[model samples]
Target chain A: MRFAGRVAVSLYLLVVSLGLAVGQRSLEVCSGCEFTSLHAAVQQAAPGDRILVRGGVYREGRLLVDKPLSLLGENWPVLDGGGEVEILTITADDVQVRGFVFQNSGVSHIEDLAALKADNVSGCVVEGNRFSNNFFAIYLAGSEHCSVRNNEVTGAATSEAFSGNAIHLWNSSSIRVEGNHLSGHRDGIYLEFVQDSSVTDNISEDHLRYGLHFMFSSGNEFRRNTFQRSGAGVAVMYSKETVMVNNRFADNWGSAAYGLLLKEINDSTVADNTFFRNTVAIYSDGSNRIEVTGNEFLRNGHAVRLLATSMSMHFTHNTFTGNTFDVTTTTSRSYNDFAENYWDNYRGFDLDRDNIGDVPYRPVRLFSMTVENYPQTMILLRSPLEQFLDYAERLLPVFTPRAIEDDRPVIGKP
Target chain B: MNEAVKVMKYGFFDLLRSRWIFVYTVFFLLITGGLLTFGGDPNQAVLSALNLVLLVIPLVSLMLGLSYYYYTRDFVELILTQPVSRPAVFLGHYAGIALPLALSFLIGTGLPFAVYRAGNETDAPVVFSLLLAGLLVNLVFSALAFWIGLANEERVRALVIALGVWLGLTMVYDGLLMGFIVLMQSYPIERSLIALSLLNPIDLSRIVVLLQLDIAALLGYTGAVFQRFIGTAWGVAMSLSSLVVWIVLPLLLALRTFRRKDF
Candidate 1:
């Protein structure tokens, strides 16, 4: 009798869930409904149940979705955390959380709390969420095969240290992060130990720190993203097999600002990017085995500032115009390759009509090295004394790096 | 000619012993020396010195020209009666003040740069350009002041025009240029703007100093034409010669006016 009863209960549960999957039952969540809160609805519903949250302010501490349910908001339901914890926490696989407004996830010294925190979940969709006053907007940790898209996050961070990244992904694989607009965060998007992810068509600007802080992320591709007016634009550190293509970075001007800072990054491709009006467009520090091609640097202080530790870098088909110094380095010996780039400073004529100039273009200026060695000399910029010294150095290779030259310089803009 | 030489020799010696020359020389030495020592950067010192050249040099030149001419009016009349020609008195008196002004400027700026840039080969060009700029400013403005002095015998009008020219070149001209740029931003204003900056001596000297520094921020405004013009051996030749023209044109006018004036 006991065995028969257990079998009947199992069959009943299986049939109900299968019915929910085939024709999902809608659980209405509102003040008039039986389930007034999203948390209550989510708790009452089984796997594959759809919860329709109505438009109203829900003072929920943390709305946890433990089952594979679809929680959709109508007319943008507000989920306020009351300045304590994350608003939404998704711990189940195949969960969908969309069209919600999240606010007031309080700051913590040790714990990094977010508006929507998804952990160890796969095949989830978190989309069209508007987040404000949250420490972090969306944080995906130990999750894979998830998509975070079309989210707009504007965080309130008065101080740099108390803030968090807008879209923070860690230890994730095969995720799609796209079409997100982020501002006023420490970092727009930060990815660490993330693999095979694609971040595309995102606009990240006006942050206190970097727009995109990528570290220890491999085989990731970010394309057509606009990162402007951040502290240092984008910082890709200790990452390999990353491709940055067609990104626009501009107007990040400060004493130590760079449009794209590549530090200890290896086997990366920086292609077709536009860097305009930055203090330093591309600052490479101990980075190696990277291909920089078809990029445009305009009106930057120093378009490319390479360190002595950088090696095996190949830059080709790039256009450098209106930049103060196209390429500046601390060392006199070069370990990088720069060829087929168009430099406005190049004075050589293409007498053979081959499109390439006969004379090599030297991008590293002696004054750059002098300023690097003696930073105070920057104040003497454009003075007759400075110009004379640079002229003399260019005439005769005295102290400038003799090897840093573009041999196949294109005659015009490339 | 001998009487003119006697007058020039006496006037030169007299000005050399004056307290104003000592004060001017000491002022230059203090500023240049302070910049070289406390400014922390030779480039910074050069920039400050460029500003000094633009403002102080012109003022000093005009003052020296006006005061010396006013005080020596009776002497000039006496020399004219003592068989000295009009051109000789004008040329000798002009040289008497101009040479000493140039000398004081050279000593005042050159001393600091020499002491600071001693054996520092990299800084030599900076020092040379700075001193050259100062010396050129002295020559151009002093020569200009002599002409103004010759044209206008009245002290107030001469001083007003001198100050006016100085203000016009340094501040008002730049203001007008900036306004024009804003008004015609859509046009290809780079080439025309480069040409415009060349019309003013202050602007030209500033350009020379900027080209020397090779700093991207300041050089960015000059555009490609300026880069091509200021970055080569020919650019330096052209700019320095332009400075010469600034001196010669004004001096010739002053000499002509002085030669024709009936006292």
Candidate 2:
């Protein structure tokens, strides 16, 4: 009697497995097919099914996926929002959306309309998509372990009021955003309340506000990203343990612009970055324990504007060349440390042949202070009087922050 | 105009043969050529050239104009006995010295760029501005020197005053402006700063170069005020017209002094 019962249970398990394998079907959505629209195909597809969408425009208002499925596009099928609603929203787990062109989502201030939005979903993958003129390109909210990669998104943003970000993440964790080209938006990439996420190999340029913005986001890593010519450049605020490595910030020139603005940030690592021709390379206000190492600051107006409120900031192994002012501070006293840096204006010699200068190199100039307090004095840049004041101040330590000197300055590029 | 041209030709030829003018030309050549080769960047060469134009050109032009007056006094008195009008001799002598100096500057700086093919479309505007600044500075300082020579009877005194003028403009004026801005830090002094920069020809030339080299830097803080005024075409026209006025006022003053003075 026990052997017969075991055989019946095994047969029942095999029949159920066979039923699942046979029930999952691949559906095609095209002009000639019965499933003419993407919404119709998604509506009819069961859980764990695959839907292949061909190259045709589907003017669907909003296609919501409540079950796990893979929506694959052959030759980039168009998902048009008809300038009225959000195009695609995923509410289920383990859903994949790939190779679709999302276009012209409505610009409504009341609704957070997005070309593609993944909400309350886990293990969601959005890849190889192109988004243009959307209110928000790809938005992930309350999602975890999702990846948005290999996407090109551009917006027709003229101002910050009406435009949205290219890729925005809110309350998401462990999300991987990689290989995305984002431009002409309010913010290229924005993160709020996001943790343990990685943003890598992205080019963010010409945005209305910031190339990349971090608000209340902690434990995020941004690597190998190029942020250039944006309104105020990349701003990392109210975040901790954020690692920004090997990034390039260039040509963010304006009255209030900075290459990287770090406000109220703590315990962050900004390493191996290149800041070129920015009005102000790194502006740190109320930030602490920031380790800025192995960075190249070239021809910037002010290489680092370290405010008095920032503390315990370490600057080492950095190269500062051709900058108007290597360091400028708001207060005459410095709490940050600068050591073993290479300065183009260093006139000290290494008499001991140790590849380190015997004398300290003072990066701050007296004219820089005067110009900081009284910006109108900027007209005196490179003048003989300014040079004389700097020379005199170097001889007699006064006015400038005397503690902001690189005692072990590298003799050459390090 | 013909008489002025004749007198100008004589002076121009005389200066071209002088060892001092040759040294000046060679000095510029060495500076530009050395910077181009050693600095390995044309933009850097232009910046160094800007400093040379600002510091050296005004002083050299002043000394040349004043000393020429003192050394050539007998010749001037002899020329006065001729049928030439005073304005002709004065304008001719001014152009004569100014042209050779301008040419020397142009050749010394421009030859390296032409040889290197370094003046791309981006660099062309900066180069043109540098040359213009040099020429205007030369003319303005030379006119002031001539006026000083005509006003002061003693050569040593005239030379001393000319040096004082250079010192005052290049060094002391900026120092005072710095002090003033610091004192008036509470108020909005951006427009006043621009007006003050226009008051000094050296500062004006410096602004022209600053607009190019440190423009990224200048677009921030008080520098933004300068960029807004100096970066626009209208601002450019205003500064340029102001520079032209600098040349005209000094030359007009010197010409008036030359016309009424009894040799």
Judging by lDDT against the true structure, name the best candidate.
2
> Can you give the DockQ of every candidate in the order shown?
0.06, 0.47
- Which runs of model 2 end up more than 4 angstroms from their true locations? A1-24, B40-44, B71-88, B114-124, B215-219, B223-227
Residue-wise C-alpha lDDT for candidate 2, range A52-156, written one tens digit per residue: 999989897898999999999999899999888999999999999999999999888998899999999999999999999998999999999999999999999
Predicted structure 2, TM vs. truth: 0.92
Worst 10 residues of 1 chain A by lDDT: A376-385
Score each candidate by Cα lDDT: 0.83, 0.88
Name the lDDT value of residue B120 in candidate 1.
78
Docking class of 2: acceptable
Docking class for model 1 is incorrect
Per-residue error (Å), model 1, residue A351: 0.7
The deviation in Å at residue A305 for candidate 2 is 1.0
